[model samples]
Target chain A: MLTALARDLAAPLAANGSFLIKPGVGLMVWTLLVFGLTMVLLSKLAFPRISAALERRQKAIEESIDTAERTRAEAEQILAEYRQRLQEARAQADEIIQRARQTAEVQEREAKERGQEIVAEASQRAQREIEAATKRALEELRNEVADLTITATEKVTRKALDPEDQKRLVEEALREMDFSGLSSGASNN
Target chain B: MNATETGGLPPRPAPEEARIPAPHPTDDPAPKSSVKRKLLIALGVYLAGLIALIAIYGFKGHRNELFKPQNEFKLESWVDLGIFSINKAVLYLFIAAALTCVTMIYIARRMQQRPNKVQAAVEALFRLMHDNITASAMDERMAAKWFPFIGTLFLFILFSNLVGYIPLPTNTENEINVFGLQIPSFSLYAATANLSVPLVLALTVFVSYTVEGIRAKGPIGYLKGLIPGGVQGGMAVPIFFLEVLSNLMRILSLTIRLFANILAGHLIILFMAGALAVILGSAWLGWFTLPFGIILFAFEVGLVAALQAFIFATLTAIYLGGAVAKDH
Candidate 1:
C-alpha cells in the first residue's frame, strides 16, 4: 500500500511550488526589502527609543532609590533632633520643679517665724494690761482703808476732832497699822 | 509495508542530511509525557522529529515549482525579479516583514514608561538580543555600531522561521492554475527553510565584518594581520592559508547552519503528520494524530525558530568581535 501511494504521488513541481530547500532569489530580494524596511523603521523609530526608554526606566529607578535613601536619612535626623529637644525640656522641667520646691520651703519658714513673733507681742500686751489693773486695785484699797480709819477715830471721840488732828491720827494709825508689808509686796509685784 | 519499515522507506533527507529518528511502533510502548515542562519540551521535539521523518518519507521528493513540473523537493520560481525569484519562500519573506513591521510599528507607537504586555515582550526580546549578541562579543562602543544589523537579522530570521508553522497551501496540487500556468500560494511559510535567505544574511555579516576589520586595522594592516607574525619560518605560509580558509569557512558554516536547522525542523513536522497517517491508515486518527501533532509541532518548531535566529545573530556578533578588536 505504501509503494502504491508513493507511485501515485505527483511530481513535486507539478502545478505546485517546490520544496524550497534551495534559496530563491526572489525570496532573497523580498527578504532584503522587508528586512531593510524593518531595519530602517526600527532603527529610525523603534529600537533606539525603546532601548532608550529601558535605559531611562533604569535611571529613573536608581534616582528613586537615591531619593528614598536621602528622605529616610533626613527623617531620622529630624527624629533625633526632636528627641534631643525633648530630653532638654524634661531636664529643664525637673530643675524648675526643684527650684520651686526650695522657694516654697523658704517662704514657709519665714511665715512660721513671723507667726511666733506676733504671738509674743500679743502676750506682752496682755501682761501690761494686767499690771495696770493691779495698780488701780491697790490704789482703791488704800483709799478705802484710810477712810474707815478716819470714821473709827470720830466714833471713839464724843465731840468732833479738828481736821488737822484727825489727819495726824490717821497718818499715825496707817503708820502703826503694819502697812510696811503691803508696801513691800506692792514693790515686789 | 508501513513507514516503520525503515529499510524500505527512509526519509529522503535534504542534501544537508539532518539527523532524524525513525518513527516508533506502538508495540514498543510510548514514553511518559508527565515530566518537567523543559524535559517534556525536549522529548516532544524528539517525537515531533520522528513524525517529521515519517512525513518526509511518506512524501518522498515532495518539492514542486510554480510553472515547471519536473523536479522533486525543489521550489521553483513563480515570478522572476530580474535579479531574484518569488515562491512560497518569498511570500513568507513578505509576510514576515509585514508582520514584524506592523508589530514593531504598533509597539513603537504604543511604548510607554509602563509597557503593556506586547510592549514588554518586545522590549525583553530587544534587550536579550543586545546583551547576548552585541555585549557578549565586544565592548559597548563597537557593539553599538553593529547592534542594529545584528538585532534586525535576529528579528527578521526569527519571524520568517516562525511563519512556516502556519498551515498554508504547500505541495504539488495546491497551486492555482491560470491558463495552464500556476501561481504558488503559501500561508504556511518558512523563509529560513530556503537556502538563499540565510546565504544573503551570511553574506551581509561577511561583508560587515570584512569592512569593520579593514576600518579597525588599515587595509594593509588587516592583510598583514591575517598572516600571524609569531610564526617566522615555512610554517608561516601554511598557517596564513589555513587562517584565511577558516575565516572563509565562517560564511559557509553560518549559511548552512541557519538554513539546515530550520529546514530540518520544518521537514520533521511534515514527516510527523505523514507518519501519523500511515500508522493509523486514515486522515483522521480518532482525535490522536492531528491534535497531538499540532501540540507537538507548536512547541518543537517554536523553539527551533528562536534558537536558529539566535545562533545566526550570535555568530555574526562574534565575527564582528574579531573584526573590531583592538589587538589581534
Candidate 2:
C-alpha cells in the first residue's frame, strides 16, 4: 500500500510543471513586503504600547507590594506601641490599686488603734468616777452613823451631858466599836 | 536447524526465556477480564461500523483518482501583475499579517492591570515570545533591540501555521453542489507550508543576524570569530571554512525545518483522511483510516504548530546573541 502510494506521489513529482520546492518570486516578494510591513507597524504602533503597558503593570504591582509591606510594618509598629501602652496602663492601674490598698490598710490600723485608746481612756475615767462616788458615799454614811449614836445615848441618860465629856465619850465609843469592818464594806460597795 | 539435528531431543529454551515465569496465582483476574471484554467489544463495534460503511458505499476498489500533486500544493494566481501576482498563498500571508497586527493592536489598546480571559491569553502569548524565546537566548540590550523583529516572526509563523489547520473554501480545483449552486470545496493549507514563505523568513533572519554580528564586531573580526578560539595555524584555515559553511547552513536548516514539518503534517492528514481509502478504492478503508487521521490532525494542531514557531524564533535569538557575544 505504501509502495503504491509512493509511486503515485513520485509520478507527478517527476513529471512536474510545478514542483513543491520551486519558489515563486512574487510570493517571496509579497512575503517580504507583508512581513516587513508587519514588523514595522508592530514595532512602531503595537509593540511599544504593549511593552509600555507591561512595564506599567510591573511597576504598579511592585509599588502595590511595597505599599502593602510598608503598611504591614507600620501596623505592626502601632500594635507594638499599643501593646506597650496597655502594659504600662495595666502596671499603673496595679500600682494605683496597691497604693490605695496600702492607704486603706494604714487608715484601718490607725482607726482601730484610736478606737482602742478611746475605749481605754473611757474605762480609766469611769474607774476614777466610781472611786470618787464611792469615797463620797462612805463619808455620808459615817456622818449618819455618828448622829444615830448620839440620839441613842440621849434617850438612855434622860439628861444632858457636858460637851467635852460627850465629845470624849463619842471618841471613846467610835474607837471601841469595830468600825473597820463597816469601813471595809462601804469601800467594797 | 531442525530438532532432528539435536539427537532427537527437544531443543532447550534460552536462559532468558527459561526465566520467564507463568502467571502467578495471586494476581488479580477481575480487572484483566474486564479489560479483555472491553477490547473485544471495541473490536466488534469497529468491525460492525466498517461493514455498515461497506454496505452503504459499496466496494469500488479500482478508482485511480486518489493523489493529485497539483491540487495539493499548487498555487493558482487569482490576479496577475508581473512579479506582484496575487494567489492563495498571498491571500493567506495577508490574512496572517493583518491578523497579527489587528490582534496585537486591539489587545494592546484594551490592556488593563487585571486582564480579562482574552487579554490574559494574549499577554501569555506575548510573555512566551518575549521571555522564553527572546530574553532567554540573548542579553537585555540585544533582546530589546531585536524583540520586535523576533516577536513579529514568531507571531507571524505561529498564526500562519494555526490558520493553515482550519478548513477554508480555497480549493478552487474542486467544487461542491449545494442547492443548485456551486461553491469551492473546503481544504486545509498553511502559508508557512510553502517553501517560499519560510525561505524568505529565514533569509531575513540570516541577514539580520549577520548584520548584527558585523555591526558588533568589525567585518574582519566577525569572520575571524567564526573559528573556535583554540585553533591556530594550518588547522584554523579548514576550521574557518567549515565554520563558515556551518553558519551558512543555518539558513537552509531553519527554512526546511518549518516548511517540511508543516507540509508533511498536512500531507499525512490528507492521505489518512481520505486519500488512502481513495487509493485502495475501498469505502470501508476510509472508516478505518479516519480515526488515525483525526488523531494526527489533533497532534499537529496541538503541538507541532506552536513548537515550530517557538524553535524558529528561539534559534533566531540565539544566533543574534552568539553573533554579538565577546566569546564568539
Candidate 3:
C-alpha cells in the first residue's frame, strides 16, 4: 500500500520542470493587487482605530497620574495649613490662660489690700470715739467732785456760805488733789 | 494492484492484516493483575506489528518510488484562463488575505480597554508588529506612515506560513473516492513556498525603500549617498557600485530567505513522513520516521513560521529606515 502511494507521488516529478523558481505572472499580479488592497483597507479602517485607542488609554493613564499627584499635593498643603492654624490657636489659648491667671493674681492682691485699709480705718475711728468719750467723762467727774466738796463743807458748818467763799474752798480742795495722776488713770481706763 | 490501477490510491489492507491481535481472556483474582496483563499484551502486539512490517517489506528497490521535492512545489492550475489562472498557491493567498482582513476588521470593530482572549491576542499581535517590527526599526513618524503596509505584509505572510502547516484537500492531482465522489487528497502547501509570492513582496519592499530614499534625498543625492562615509576619490566609485549591488541583493535575500525557509521546512516534513520510508524500501521505517516528522512539523509551525514573518517585516522596516536616514 505504501509502495503504491509512493509510486503515485513519484509519477509527476519528471514532467513538472522547475516550478519552484518559475515566476507565475498571475500569482505575482494577484499578490500585488491583494497585498495593496489589504494595506489600503487596513490603513484606512483597522490600524487607525487601534492606534487611537492605545493612545487614548495612554493619555488617560498619564492624566490620572497627574491628577493624583495634584490631589496629593493639595491635600498635603491643606494639612500643613491646618497644622499651622492649630499651632496658632494653641499659642493664643496659652496666652489667654496666662493673662487670666495674671489678672486673677492682681485682683486677689488688690482685694486683700482694700480689706486691710478698711480694717485700719475702722480701728482708727473707734479709737477716736473712745478718746472723746473718755475726755467727756473726766470733765463730768471733775464738776461732780466740786459740787460734792461744797455740800460737805456746808454740812459740817451747819450754815449757808457765799458764792465767793464756796468757790475759793472748792479751788483749794481741787488744788490739793493730784489731778495729773487722775487724768493719767482716766486715759489708761 | 498498483496505485495507477487504483486511481492513485492504495488498496485497503485485508481484515487480518489490519487487525491488532486481541489479548487472551483472563479470569484473574485481582484487578491490578488484570490491568498489568492488558498492558503487557498491548506492548507485545506493538512489537509484533513492528517485526511483521520489517519482515514483509525489507530494504529493497523502492528508491524510484520516492516522492520528489519538486513534485510537492509543482503549480498545476485548477483553472487556466490564459494569463490569469487559479492554483492551490493562489487559493492559499486568497484565504490568507481574507483571513487577515476579516480578523483585523472584526477585532478592530470589537476592541476594548480590557480585552477578552481573542481581542487580547489580536492586540498583542498588533503591538508586536507595531513596536517590535515597525517602531523599533524606524522613528515614530516613518513607523506610522509604513506600519499598515509592513503590518499587512507580516500578517499575510504569517497566515500563509501558518496555514501551510495545516493539511488541506488541495492535492487535486491525487484524488480519493469517498461515497462515489472524487475528492482531492489532503496535503500541506504554502503560498510563501513559491518563488513568485515572496519575490513579488520583496520587489514591493525594494520599490518602497528606493522611492522613500529618493523622496527623502533628491535623486542625485540619494544615488550619491550610497557611497559609505570616509570614502573618497577613486575608491568612491567601486564602493558606490558595490553598495548599489548590495541594495539590489536585498530583494533576492528577502525572497530567498522566506521562500527557501518555508519550502525547505515543507520538504523536510514530506521526506520524514513517508519519502524516507519509500527511499529505504522499508514500510517499518515509517514508524520511526513519523515521530521525527511530527517533531519537524512542530518546529516549523511553532518557530519557523512566525520567525520568518518577523524577520521579513523587520528587514523591510530597516531598509526603509536606512533609506530615509540622514547617515545613509
Model 1 spans > 4 angstroms off: A1-21, A108-189, B1-76, B80-83, B170-172, B175-187, B224-234, B275-292
lDDT of 3 by residue, B118-213 (tens): 977888899999999999989999998999989999999999999999999988877899999999888899999999999999999999999999
Give lDDT: candidate 2, residue B194: 92
In candidate 2, what are the lDDT values of residues A34-68, reduced to their tens digit?
99999998898888888888899999999999999
Tell how far residue B6 is off in model 3, in angstroms. 81
Clashing pairs in 3: none
The estimated TM-scores of all candidates read 0.65, 0.81, 0.69
**Tens digits of per-residue lDDT for model 1, B1-328:** 4567667787565554445555566535344433466697876876676566556554333332232322223554667666566655666788887887778767877778888788889988988889977889988998887788888898888888777787776554456777888854443447777788888888778888988899989897776677765776888788878988988898889988987777666544554555435433433331234555576688757687888889999989988898766555
Q: Over 4 Å off in model 2, which ranges?
A: A1-18, A129-189, B1-47, B56-60, B66-70
Q: Can you write out model 2's per-residue Cα lDDT over B1-328, one digit (the tens) per residue?
A: 4688778788766689668897786576877888899999988998899999889888666666545744667888789888788988998999889999999998888888899999888888889989988998888988999999999999999989998999988887787888988887889899998999999999999999999999999999899989888889999999999999998899999999999999989988987898767766777988888878999999999999999999999999999999988777
Which stretches of candidate 3 lie above 4 Å from their native place? A1-17, A85-189, B1-52, B55-61, B64-66
Give lDDT: candidate 2, residue B161. Answer: 94
- Model 1, A78-184: lDDT tens digits are 99999999999999999999999999999999989898888898777766666666667656766676677777777887567788977787678667766556555
List fnat, each candidate: 0.71, 0.73, 0.74
How are the candidates ranked when ordered by DockQ, highest leading?
2, 3, 1
Best by TM-score: 2
